[model samples]
Target: MAVAQLVAGQNITIPGDRAYCFSVQIADWQWGVIVSRQNGSLSLLDAIEGASISDDRLLLNLSDIPEDIEKLTVYIAAGVNNTGNRTANSSIAPTAGMSARLSDLVDAKEYASIDISQQLTGQLAVSLIEVYRRNGAWKIRCILQGYREGLSKLLESFGFTRDSYAAAVASISTSASTIATASAVNREQTDTQAPVNQEAGDASITLVWKSGQGSLRSAARYFMGKNFKPVSDLRIGCFYELENGQRGMVYSFDASLEGSFDGVPYIKASRAQNQHFEQLLINARFRHKLNRFLIFASMMDAHDSWGGLNVDVEFQLPGVAAQTLSPTTLMVKPIYAVAMINFNDEQTKMTPLDEYFQDLAEMDRAFAWGLPWQCENNSDNEDQT
Candidate 1:
């Protein structure tokens, strides 16, 4: 018997297997060394949108907060109470001018909270941001990075809304603007089919319809009031009126848009073409206000099949509104949906044209023909999952 040990830079062969005998393979990965450096790219901000004026909150200290924020809400906080503000860290000598520009504008009479934006600039060494929490009766510090992303997203889901999303977009500073102008999407063709509240004047929708790849449309919904807070998750669906005065439903859904309003959650939805059905996801984000989003889908051709490759959606909340509409009762609605076209390559090659119709129909089916179980009816949605 012979004992042999083959080492690096050496080759050995014995049996007559042509494949493995001539080839050298490494199964173990050589992760040379563990580099311990500060987590620079890791973000530590949370975006929040309050549905009603009372639910206003924000996660600050990062240029990328929305990457994980859940929903943007608008609600009226009690009111603003001004106070001289400063940022202090007991960890070391406080940096001069490290003071937070914006203070928590809590309602003077009540403790309702509001948003105040300002730079946490000046001489600073700690790259961390100050996050205040109303603990019991005092404010406590809660950081994002060292903390959990899930927790951050959860905490920044709700916010206050005071203006129309359309108007809000128009107001964005040139530096922060992410959306580029394009011909209005299939908004005109489908706007009528959508369940729009025209009575809520000063609000208009833009849309465009595409065929293959898919269609893309974006719109901002606005409610009139000084300070507004969404008390319940708003319901969205499409409908078509029949010749006989009957109406058929289209897509109806509920998703917490960019739970956070800042980076980490901002959207940059642009483009005039639907290369691979990116439109479907845009349509999805329409339910909520988003700053940036990326949706992928497949369309065999320019005439058939249209859906998402994958979807990334986000949102942000405007300042609180003085008044917000309240529905008489909670409405049952869908949260998530998927559409499958019966067409295949053998039949006609799912092309752009067909994909357009498929997506439009999908929009219809999403609302009128959603899943069997309603998300509103689901205990999970009720429990805030």
Candidate 2:
């Protein structure tokens, strides 16, 4: 069989098969998901299954679909850095038909594929494909829908508010008795290690270094049964784009060298050399004037592939209770966290951070800055671009 090739708005039907596999390959800044359906309505308000993503591709499965559910859709969203032109390739194939499609028999292929390239300008996400049931048969359709706003808004159109969707997923997962039981026991043990002591005061956050090579005495302190240490060797710095279009580090180490917050010299340590402590304190002062605050914690010696060490960070936001992000691994050299703070002077003055402690929980996901960074004098150019 000659497999059908599809383009935008084209669709194909596969009778007798209850499952289908959808996949995509794309350049950086693109990610995909399989949105489920039930009773003709999209079921994206809760946790979904069969969503798989690999390097440059996303793979989704449609299996054990409910009787009332008729279709499966794939959503592709742009990451934070998706501002230029890009290209993508995708296909839909029946798992059971894989062998026949590759056989010597004179037959049509059992898959449909497409190549797409377009300029994306500040869009949140897009709906690329759809697979549905038509008269007791499964069918696939190409949908090149685009949303200019962003992913969060694109999801909202399906009657899914971010909070509602997150709550639904949590509720469903918690309802799983086996996993719940195991998680409860695990939580009990983990809670013992992380002890928080709330005290009335201003916002003061401390990052402690627990593992790797470091002296734990001079900068270390005990606070109500908790240990606080600092990683002297590592550099925690910020990149800001001020409201005045003045973008760059707070204090430049050497004026002779050229550097911008977003552009090269992409190397920061050279700019931050021997002035890490001064830079951090300088960042703290301009909290009110900052338009964007991207914090980065990097270890210059983190080149080995064998193992990693743990580092702890604690925070005491004024009016907010004390909190800690404990024992995170320095698996990668530069770990970045985007601190989302209120920039409005009036709002910043009125609202105590303690009233909104929810943001602190997102620290663990601070694995990448989404921007580029290169270490000066380092020869290994892997992932530097």
Task: Give the best candidate by lDDT.
Answer: 2
For residues 113-181, write the lDDT of model 1, one tens digit per residue: 111112222211211222211221122121112112221122233221223222332343232343222
TM-score, per-candidate, Cα-based: 0.20, 0.34
lDDT of 2 by residue, 1-385 (tens): 3566566688876543222334455443355444555643444412233222223322223333446666556666655322212224222211122110111101112466655443223344666677677777767787766676655666676666667555544554555565347434433433354433333222223333434542223312344232443333543444444443333332122332222211111212223233322122222323444354444444433222112434443443433444444323333333334243333442322121211111212322242323223332321212221
Model 1 regions lying over 4 Å from their true place? 1-172, 175-336, 340-385
Q: Which whole-number lDDT from 0 to 100 does residue 75 have in model 1?
A: 16
Best-fitting candidate, scored by TM-score: 2
Instruction: Show how many residue pairs clash in every candidate, following the order shown.
Output: 87, 10
Residue 369 lDDT in candidate 1: 37
Give each model's whole-structure lDDT.
Answer: 0.21, 0.39
User: What residue runs in model 2 are displaced by over 4 Å at the alpha carbon?
Assistant: 30-36, 45-63, 80-110, 118-122, 168-385
